[model samples]
Target: MDKFPIHIAFNFVFLRKKITGIRVHAIELFRALEEQKETKYIFHVITTKEGADILNEHGIRANGGIKVHIIASSFEKETDRLKLQLFSLNNTLKQNRIALLHCFDYLTPLQRPAYAKIIATIHDLIWLENPNTYSLPKRLFKKVFFSHSIRKADALIAVSKTSKESLIQHYGHGYDQKTTVIPNGLRNTFLTIKKQGNPERLIKGEYIIAVGRYLPHKNYERLIKAYAHCNTKAQLVIAGSDMDKSVDLQRLAQELGLNDKLLLLKNPTDAELISLISHASLFVMPSLTEGFGLPLLEAMSLSTPVLCSDIPVLKEVCENAALYFNPLSIEDMAAKITYALNSSPILQKLIENGHERVQAFSWENSAKQVMNLYDDLLLNY
Candidate 1:
């Protein structure tokens, strides 16, 4: 007798919004699954029209093995839109007889078919950690919807052990058996990109690089202050999308009289970002918290030394391959930056160790693990 292929569905609704780390993960994982020949599975992606367009732009829709289900819905109101999506998703799963659904953005159809199992990936609980950062309505939505989705999920994937612990700590116990720590993987493009020499227009001289969204938890203000106190003449290059916190960081730089030494590139293209990381003297992650610190891994893959905040998740992600600093203490952060830049031997070791550490993660491996989990879940049926 021949073995049957497993049919699974993936939620790609996140593509409707601006591209973020979560969206990237969904895309990369899908691509990896498509490339895997060892697994005989039929993959179905449930996405909005916009999501389909984005996938088409990336040539992902060209794969004959993957089926794309486009659900049309208006986005005028969040609640109504979710309702429409849930209805469409439930119908899609039942119509196609999909045995499993993987939600990459910590959300799922409110009403799932009895035959379909859910696996949700919780990237972070930032709003739960700091409610003040979000609006009251947003917080309420997250509290209600996220809690419902998580409870309904048959299994969960946490990007890091720290993220898994946070989930249980804030949401109560009994999640250990259901949750798996699967770190996000870097794109092969970042690993293969040739390091470009500094473009005088992009940066004046040797620069320290930082990349992330302009969010309060990112701690850009503290990083700017610490960079000012450093003895080196290297410019501080911060590349990320500008959000509500952008003005505050810009004002802080101006107030410190270091505007000339600070470079802010908002929403850089992937090629530009890779080039920047490839040539940087060091890549720093000043965020007070991170789900997995994907950028640190990206830097490591590109042979760039990393300096990140002394947070549990950062430590878990970088191991001893990265230099750490107190995110809250400007003095400590400055000292660590200076030490990293000045100590050639330590920097060399970090670069080598980072390369070795990054070998442990790859999209292909992560996809295999996910496929195995699907197999385990479907075996019961």
Candidate 2:
């Protein structure tokens, strides 16, 4: 069988099938490719049931205007799941015409001998940081899988300059030749939705909004405490799917006597989220670590002024377009919130700046870069 020039299959080895940052990138890339009628490319995605469902909901499939393949497998352990994914991708490639394999993570042993030119996108530098953040078994697993993935990938695409630097620091190779920096693209739907719901609700009160999964890394616990010290009239609304470990955060909110002021909403629709972000007096991100913070851009695209942590990656993404608050200092966070609440002029300027800055990034532009990269690699081969 003659392989197509851009028959690329992306593999993200996992059984959880969460629509995380990696999955979002995969979907957006395909969406961008599908829009270009002149490009003859087929982007197949091998994932689990949940991932397939997500793509299906977005109308992306092999039969639905874009070429996508969903390889389903069930395995409990991470290593075994990866091994299963490797075997599946290998079988799929053998039966079909595939020239490129763009894997989100590293390939397993079964995929190593395949003839496809591989391009791997590293979503984070998880291995560079201390392993003590997770349990003993997880630490051991990271030591194996993360290290192996980086070593084996033909071309490494980092989602941000920070991630690229972290990869060079940890892997000791692929700094110049194989590694490339491509920032994560923002979805346009966040800005397209016209904010029209209850006008009465809009006039209810001014509040700050924070959105993310209820994970420890998001540092919502600290955010709630920090918000407690803000103006009594200004409320903080934390919205996300309550994770397995988020019960502690809820308890912390109660302990801080913020049961009424702090609102916890679970898994809101994108429209609802956008409304919240658009109407928010301030959008804050107090994450301890992030590969690329998508919410910061989403808020900015909605013309919402952002108050994010003073972390390097956040600063890199937000630039001088956002107001920064020290993540370590509750005093600083509270003060920023207070300042925003007290000054209408500052709020207007920040929102304008945020809107202007976020215009530079788009899913279409990201997709174009990825497609062009594919063409270049194919020519080289």
TM-score of model number 2: 0.89
| Candidate 2 structure lDDT | 0.72
What digit string (tens of lDDT, one per residue) describes model 2 on residues 1-381? 454445666664452544466666766666776786344566666676655666677766566334545565455666667556656677776565667777765444346435677787777765346343467876676677776766776677888888878777777765657887777777645545644432124324878889888765677877887888876576788877654456787788889888777777777767677778878888999977778888888888777889988987889999977888888788888888888778888888888888788887787887777777777777744
Compared with the true structure, model 1 gives a TM-score of 0.92
Question: Stretches of candidate 2 above 4 Å error?
Answer: 1-6, 12-18, 37-39, 64-66, 73-83, 105-113, 130-133, 194-204
Residue 105 lDDT (model 1): 73
Model 2, residue 103: displacement in angstroms?
1.9
lDDT of 1 at 60: 76
Judged by TM-score, which candidate is best?
A: 1
lDDT of 2 at 238: 84
